[model samples]
Target: MTSSYGLTRLVLTDFRNYGSAQLTCDVRPVILTGPNGAGKTNILEAISFLSPGRGLRRAKLSEVTRNNEESKKPEKEQNSSLSWAWGIASTLSTPQGSWDIGTGLEIQEGKERRIVKIGGEILKSQTLLRDYVHVLWVTPQMDRLFQEGAATRRRFLDRLVYGLDSMHVTRVTRYEHYMRERSRLLKYGGADRHWFDALEARMSAEGVAISAARRQFIDHLLQAKAWTLGTFPQAELALAGQIESWLGAYSALETEEKFREVLKASRQQDRESGGVACGPHRSDFTVTYREKNRAAAFCSTGEQKALLISIVFAAARLQNLQGAGVPLMLLDEIVAHFDERRRAALFEEILSLKMQAWMTGTDIGLFTSFNNKVQYFRVENAMVHEKSVLIKM
Candidate 1:
């Protein structure tokens, strides 16, 4: 079976620095070399859009469109093409099959909306894209993940969980929607008790489900041998959220009941604070360097980066071992600091998993170690050109 999976074709228009761009590739690992400001990361960001949420940069949709005179024109003065200020069309492949993912911006209901088409049929919801494509990415922005806020760590964990279970996205979306509505009702004081009860019930249900997935994902990661048999250091993971802790002693139903009471009791506090205090939203994911027995926050920058790579490798391994679709890896500027041992390990993992990973770095020498195992590309002026690879050895 051809386990390699990822975009075989990608087209971008009016996105970031590129006015028009496209690339086609096979299932081999891809290496893009370019100087700073050459739009190397932009290509990775384009791939990230194939999945849910904002791209790796978390940039606003407006920020992604190329800034040109046409983009600034008045609505009536704009042409049909103007509505698509930014767009990404691509074909993503897994071992199971290939999918045609046509997604981009469109003007609907007097507002900008992202629309998706699979094989020329418009999808009712973007959530359906999850079933066909799974994307995982690491960028320089996430280099400080351990030092960053809890929200960042939570999102990182959720992305890993999403690959295994497609419904995880829907559960999270419903949980966040209810959380916001409940917060609004508490703040504005207009909703009825029945509405409050209904919203809390839904949130508790979804929150419990989210926590359960995270718990199971962590267990799989702990057991995955990738973390133990790699050049990267082993990372110890833990959840410091109330719901996660409650799962140890209380059953799922009991935890949901407990959460409902907590939400009811916290209404006044949440209202005054303008935020929910105790749901999965408040959960914090913590990491430790298992060998050193030190928190990730205390680790050196290089060590922190290694720990992240270790975790991602382990997650990919688990997905393949359990028969979940292998995720496409979009690593931006990842190998600049990698030592020889670590670099070789990363290459071995990618080849072993048969994952179509798109990796970027400024220096091509950092990647010559792969020799003939990878395809090389040169990125310049918002475009990618295929290049011949010359093995160093």
Candidate 2:
């Protein structure tokens, strides 16, 4: 199920803690190793920002700049306040077309400006950016995902769904706007029932669609379970909330209407809370290891890590089959806590999936089991250096 990348280059100038660095690799699995605060994670964050949502850290554009501008050797007149260009290039090969597709980010003061260009022509809609690139990542922060609140897991699900369904981003975006307006109306001392009526209908349509897409993704995940479990533990996933219950018993349109009515009735309570109290927004994903018959959250740490890795590998393989390109994986310190056997299994599974995975760890020995064919790099003081992907074949 291996897939090749159409794009591969990260050029950064005057960005964040990084003084100035250019990173290039052969699209093979890469491992970045460095001490904490040495800016290894920052590189991953840069790549994450290239995608739709907030970067890996989800920090504001302003927070990404360095503190002492003079320390990194000022760029003379490069505009200290203007965080300069950061872009990714993808090499495309086709009989009718052969060129690079790129997306760049520029920040001035506190606002971020994104420009999407193909072979140098600027695009009108940012949506055009997704056609060329799709990114999926996991950070150390996500290690406790199952133990977190439902909202946290919902966010994770939305990110995964976004990779498979580009339109899902638009649906969620429109629904969010509707929610904001509805909340504003509620915040006011008085509001017309008609106000809630129109907006609630729109919200209901989008919300139900959003939930349906999520369920579809989970279902695909389950359908792939037999193959997924061969490399890792077997797991069963259950959807928890009104949307799931409605989906179990009603048709799509009926579920949408039922969700609409629920939203209408919850307005009074929502007004009191200042946020929607019930809906797909409140839904959760319950994961159970079928063999162990126990919730993922309560499973041993090693078991949980294996489960997470298994799901990610499954999604990558699915993407390949769907011609979604190999999902560019950004993993940070993924094997830090794993024992040798698990570490070897993780490496083997990654190779089996054949996606271009980028990982970070402090242990140089972590990647020793890999073949010399894997491309590798080292990070220090925000600078990246190319190293042999594997020390020996």
Candidate 3:
């Protein structure tokens, strides 16, 4: 069955470059065409905030609020202070029904806090968002994922896993928190043995959970059927890290115990390094072209881009099979790099998946293949307006 859920209404207030905007459209792909610095990506970033964490840009909470023009005025002449807040509300139509989901930043006690509301009632935590919708995005910045350091790749893998397993976020957050506390204690050089042991025990438990979740995702991806009739090549996924290395030879429990021992043994080294010596925190993900048997990093630039797209497609399919409802896809300037044939294929795949994809590009012609099939919008001067005419391909 095709997905029966998509965003029907979106409203942005004091968000990024847009002071106020509302977009209404059917649950189909949305093509946003605009020049650079026209706030195209800002729209996608707002949608990304619907899910938990730092959103697509990984920006600070304060950074998302639109800078007040009044703030620039002379201190005595300014009419009002900036609200220092932003809001996003959307109507999500699912097979079960429709619900209004809202998220925004509210200043509390001189600090900005993220708030979530469903159908006008406040939600206690952002994690509640996973039950209503799943969001996936690709940005121009991600083009360098393979070429970047291991930390970026790890984050990429975690995001993919988070889509499949919502609890992965909580586990990762807890693991990182414990690791930070442990690192702080190590750095101080006077950590108590008992307290350090307690911290390591907690870290081991959460670390194993994080590693297990990642491994499960990788295993699922590896066994998934390859994409057919696509120009992109399938990727061979692998995990590299101390915890991942032990999973093959030991049960999770055993590995946790071993990890605790390793932590204790490496305390001096960790102290010297000023960080956790080894754990899931240091894990890395490696991708290879299945057919060519070459590492993704070694692939040509265009080939690498294609490979990334292939993996995203594979991930989308996997989520579908796993019964995650239709995921909203945000493709930022993705069409700018693809040829006509590839662009057509990309649109077809999105249609087949029945996903509500938000695509951005400077040239509307790149999305001519989707004319009349998707909502068209023009983003300019920090404002988004629906295009009146649909240009035929």
- Which candidate has the highest TM-score of all? 1
For all candidates in order, the CA lDDT equals 0.85, 0.73, 0.85
TM per candidate: 0.95, 0.87, 0.92
Per residue, candidate 1 scores C-alpha lDDT tens digits across 33-147 of 9889998999999888888888799988878888877546476747544366678889877666888888787765457888788888888888777888888988889988999
- Residues 1-393, candidate 3: write the lDDT tens digits: 335678888999888888889989878889898888999999999989888778999999889988978434355433333333789999988989999999998875566778999999998888778778778888888878898999888888887887789888888888888988888888866768999999999999999999999999989877877465257677889999999989988999999999999999998898888888889989889999889999999988777878888877788888888877557999998887878788888898988889899999998888877767788999998888999665854
Question: Whose TM-score is higher: candidate 2's or candidate 3's?
Answer: 3
Q: Which has the greatest lDDT?
A: 1
Ranking of predictions according to TM-score: 1, 3, 2
TM-score of 2: 0.87
Q: Which stretches of model 1 miss by more than 4 angstroms? A: 69-82, 108-110
For candidate 3, the per-residue lDDT at 78 reads 35
lDDT of 2 at 312: 71
